[model samples]
Target: MATITVFGATGYAGGHITDEALRRGHEVIAVNRSGSAAAREGVTPVAGSIGDDALVRDLAARSDVLVVAVHGSADGQPYLAALVPNLLKAAAEGGARIGVVGGAGSLKVREGGPRLIDTAGFPEAARTESASHAKVLDALRAADTGADWFYVSPAAEFGAWVPGERTGTYRLGDNVLVTDEHGKSFISGADYAIAFVDEIDEPAHHRARFTVAY
Candidate 1:
């Protein structure tokens, strides 16, 4: 099993990813700004900010997969802009693959039109951070490092999703949003975890962004 390190292990998405990674028998090193919570049996909690280059590099050096799940605003701060690049550099130095938890705001709505964040009904508060997420995606695309990277965007209906039964079934999409026959886009947190773990097991859609939906 691959040794995986999740950068934002305390957050909702990151926590779910950590749980799923452990369930699949992968060694997980969970990193949070304030360190990790009570020790889990198989997960190692690493304490440090994503801006700590030395710590990040050390963690990356020890892992096979570096999962970037950090949440921050586009406030013109160094942390916001430097997070992805720092992780990429560390991953390259460590010879590991990178997996980014991307934002749905950047996902294409039409073939060549604006993204969902540009459309009406998008929350103003979320737009600020969503833009940061977009920048992370752009940076990953432009990165010339030979290290493999994958961007995974959750359905537009993400956040506070109730856990559904893990039927081990979900649809995957590329760039475009994934909606069900009812014309609704949603995926339970549990199912999203399943998809992320599956991707970890079988490396598909490398160096590209993909989404999951029920």
Candidate 2:
């Protein structure tokens, strides 16, 4: 089993990823700002901010895969820009595979055109958070580190999605969105976790970004 480290262990997406990692029999280390109590048999909780370079580096050095599921605040906090690069650096030094829980706003809507966030009918309240995500993507793309990293963007309607039965079935897509036969783009959190852990086990798409939807 792979040694995995989840950066934002208390968040919704991160928590689900942690559970899925544990269920897959992988050893998981959950890193949170304060601390996390959602303990499992094989899950270890590490308390520290992403800004603490020493602590993050120590955790990264011990893991094989690092899952970044951190979300910046809507009030224009510079945490995303600051933390991700540092984590990426540590992961590179540790020779670890990086998996990012990316935002849907970074996904493209057209070929070499604007993203989904810029398109019409997008909610105004989400623009700031989306922009922050875009910035994080830019930083990751421009990074020169030599680590295998995959950024996974969930469906447009992803938030507080309850888990369905563990069918282990989901569709993957590239930069563009993925939709079902019913013209819907959504995946349950459980299915998302399945995809995430599957990628962790067998990395088919290396150094690229992908999405998941039912």
Candidate 3:
């Protein structure tokens, strides 16, 4: 029954997380530029920018967990790279753990293997965002704040184009990529939401990165 604050509540991952959390009877603060109402009921909406350190600190201080699914690379903003430091500051001030939504580009296919983004077949449309997200993860790993934070990377076949059904099952992985017998990795949005909230309740993989896939 933790109070969770989602920084990009209108987006795909954040919206799904908000839905799953509310379904589980947790308090949700959905933050977005518009502060728009969540499509579902039982959500408290907050309209603001993550760059506001004071506001973010106040929110983080009040909540038990802060879910960061905000990224602006595609729109040419790169806000996540700039927001990580302030988020670290806010989390440190408020004692809230951060649950970061990560990109698959950072996941290693094998020990000492090249990252997915560095691989030849990566999409050009994803290259900028992937690099930006990688930078955010790097900052989170190197930050001196000592705040509890963890990154959650999705699978290779994740995204709207790959909409999958709720299998009610998923596999968790470390920094390495998780794949099926056919080497295909995927997870539905609803299932990913379940996995994300599960971490908030269980608090496993603290201060580290863990991923999910089918």
In terms of TM-score, the best-performing candidate is 3
> What is the TM-score ranking, best to worst?
3, 1, 2
Q: Flag the better candidate by TM-score, 2 or 3.
A: 3
lDDT of 1 by residue, 24-137 (tens): 899999898777544887789888877788988998899999887787563543245557777788888998888887788998776787798999988887887888888888
Q: How many residue pairs clash (N, CA or C atoms closer than 3 angstroms) in each of the candidate models, in the order given?
A: 0, 0, 0
Candidate 2 local lDDT, 2-103, one digit each (tens): 999898888888888888988879998888977764776998888887668898788888999988888854466545865667878888998888888888
Best by lDDT: 3
Backbone clashes counted, model 1: 0
- Return the TM-score for each candidate structure: 0.92, 0.92, 0.95
CA RMSD, predictions in order: 1.9, 1.8, 1.4
Candidate 3 residue-wise lDDT, 77-136, digit = tens: 465877788898889889899999889998898789988889988998888888899888
RMSD, candidate 2, Å:
1.8
Off by over 4 Å in 3: 39-41, 72-74
CA lDDT of each prediction against the hidden true structure: 0.82, 0.82, 0.87
Q: How good is model 1 by TM-score?
A: 0.92
